[model samples]
Target: MAGAEDAGERADRFLAARFDGVSRSRIKGLIEGGAVTVDGATLSDPSLRVKAGQTFAIVVPEPEPAEPEAQDIRLAVVYEDEEVIVVDKPAGMVVHPAPGNPDRTLVNALLAHCGASLRGIGGVRRPGIVHRIDKDTSGLLVAAKSEPALTGLQRQFADHSARRSYLAVVWGVPNPLAGEIEGDIGRHPVDRQRMAIVARGGRPALTRYRTIRRVGSRASLLECRLATGRTHQIRVHLAARGHPLVGDPVYGRTRGARNAGADAAARAALAGFSRQALHAATLGFSHPITGKWLEFESPLPEDMGTLLARLELI
Candidate 1:
């Protein structure tokens, strides 16, 4: 409960603030489980309006144990060592299991490949995972197989020492060609599913972008480097600049090819595109256990390559 000060706010919003490490979806789960009550009646809705002075009682259950089943999934191994493993993750592969994606993740693959050693190294559920790239954004990701590697990699990520570069095809060509995007990113006010630039209660984010190739005057290929890693940082920052990546479902234009001055073939291809035109092209970090500096680069996926080919000839 948020007391009397925040009377009219949505229940999920205030509950999210009050409950640390609990997401809005988790709060809805509590509401569904009859864990929230007010005035002796259980609240069944997550959107209940709270009048001033009405107290809400909540019962939060203990976190469920995370035990993911291993599967014989194929992995595109980039580089591997006794302490760490790097894989060039294809688009559409989840790094770890979550609510909607329960199994068949990178964790499952790692478990099947590494056996018991992969468990309890990083954390439960997502063992051996360090950082994450979005499922639709293909790229290179490194996972630690031991405690020392985990701790070292976590420290590097916390201090923003890990380097990540992404390649994106935005709908419009930016005027400056190359620059930095600085903002405070947080949950969108109205749309909880998306991140946005907010004035308060946001983490500082920075993205540096340079134009690699111009797809005519309306679209361009860019290389974006991250100084800070926030959820959807590159996508949000580029969208905020009015140059959202092509085929981005949440933060991009639907008729982007028309805006890109494309011909009929290109426009049809753009319309048929399924995922964001972004890829994690490069990654660099110090070896967690060996103290060796390591870097890896991935070529654009076939889909992005085909999309670019269509746009370039337009």
Candidate 2:
């Protein structure tokens, strides 16, 4: 059963194309979980080449009920209305519940704040989560309180119409003051936990950045704007350009160690910095229900601000 058109296609890719609204990652997970079969034989290898005319079957189990409890956590509520709520999320806070992080997330706090209004927006686990920032990155995020708001926000993000801008302190200044970084981002072939720039079989990603200020020729503050919302888009793009973010544990170790010329204060500041010096400074999108254009901004947190001051002083 070899069809010329379908031969040599990766199993996961082939299945993902056939299944609407299911992600390739999800397809791989299903395959690894023994929920996918080829010609009545269980196939667990997501990368196996697909032969044309073969019968592929997938078993999708019902999602487990999400039973997260609400906690009284304080939030930096920037704006709130009947439709949506915007918060200036601090660094180190996970947006939703995961295996390791089951509680004390933004979702828990929102559950307490929004009460029953958040129900049925983003399903049980990620109710109202339209978009997300990394746990170590801080910045503005908006969550829907109503179904219309959630649908509207999701549409804008899907269409790449939402404007998201971030500020980061990176190891070196870019050659040009402003430019665009374009690449195909996908999972690392070897390290499943990390992402990488791939030659093919990846989604397109674009990041526009400009140098905000140079910190004594050792570091620079850059404003990065996202054209495509991929996981770790800004971090991966800047790291690929050899300007990894300051204090980024995942991508900055080698580059950060090269900052040798800074003075004692600057070195101390750089070493003391804990998380990546990245913040979602600005977010703008149209109101899903009212069709009104709304925007929000957040200033640098105290930790990043103090570090920048020390860099300037040195």
Candidate 3:
């Protein structure tokens, strides 16, 4: 039953507020899928206004079987124990299945590797996923093998206690060399497909960055530490600061065009780069069951290393 305070609130928003751990977007998806009812009548409008004291019911369907098929995809296993498995995910691999990418994901590979151990960890579709990195960003990620591990790892991430760091090659060196980017991030008002630093109604995000090396004024290698794990945090924050990553398709156009004045060698190097120059270099967390601290590191992938070498030569 909706209380007096929820009177006139949108149905999706009302249900989202009443239910904990459920996102408003998920609630809307459920409503649109015809899984919610009001007074026993199915309602699909997410924006329907709620009346005080009205009864609402939601039907939670049994989780569907994960559709992704396991394949013998190669994975770079970093560290593994009975509770968790850490992998150095390469670039261009989707972390999980989605609309366009339904197979050949890290989840599919894990299913094959872990077999029945991953049966009930994250959900049918997600399996052991606790966090995710972008498709083009390569780095270290840890997956839970057991229910306790999943719950523990999730709590650590939620509390912002886990340490996640990345290395990125941005177009130009930041003036200060070391600082933090603080902003509220949400979906772009105009572009819908990309994230942006919003003026209002966005989640708080923070990133700390320092220059690791400078490539003669044309570019800089930077190390970034995440304080909050918002989607596209590092990419969006760096772009907002006028230093979009090299080879970042969505955010690098302006900076790339500006770099046209660079010498021929630098131009060629940038042109040869095919994906964003970002890598998840390090990850640290407590073992879910052992109560011991564990940290793992991955070196820059071959392509990024080659780009750096070229930049240095120029």
The candidate that achieves the highest TM-score relative to the unseen native structure = 1
Error of model 1, residue 131, in angstroms: 0.8
Can you write out model 1's per-residue Cα lDDT over 1-314, one digit (the tens) per residue?
A: 44678788777777777778889988887886678887768876787766776767788866644577778999988998778888898888888876557678888888887776654653553456788998888988999888778899999998989988999999877879999999999988766568899999999999999999898545799999999989999999998888888888888853543455355655665865788888998889999877899999998888888888777666
Lowest-sum lDDT 10-residue window in model 1 = 253-262
Model 2 spans > 4 angstroms off = 1-65, 122-126, 255-266
Tens-digit per-residue lDDT, 1-314, candidate 3:
99899899999999999888888998887786777999889886888899998898887655555467877899999998777999999999999876446678998898888776664654563356889999999999999988889999999999988999999998877978999999999987765458899999789999999999897557899999999999999999999998898888887766453663256877778766788899999999999888899999999999999888877766
Q: Please, what are the lDDT tens digits per residue for candidate 2 over residues 246-307?
A: 88878775644365334576567776678989999999999999999999989989999988
* Comparing 1 and 2 on lDDT, the stronger one: 2
All candidates: TM-score: 0.80, 0.77, 0.77
Give stretches of model 3 more than 4 Å off. 1-65, 122-126, 255-257, 260-263
Write the candidate numbers in order of decreasing TM-score: 1, 3, 2
How does residue 81 of candidate 2 score in lDDT? 86
**Which candidate tops lDDT?**
3
| Number of residue pairs clashing in candidate 3, backbone atoms closer than 3 angstroms, sequence gap of 3 or more or interchain | 0
Clashes of 1: 0
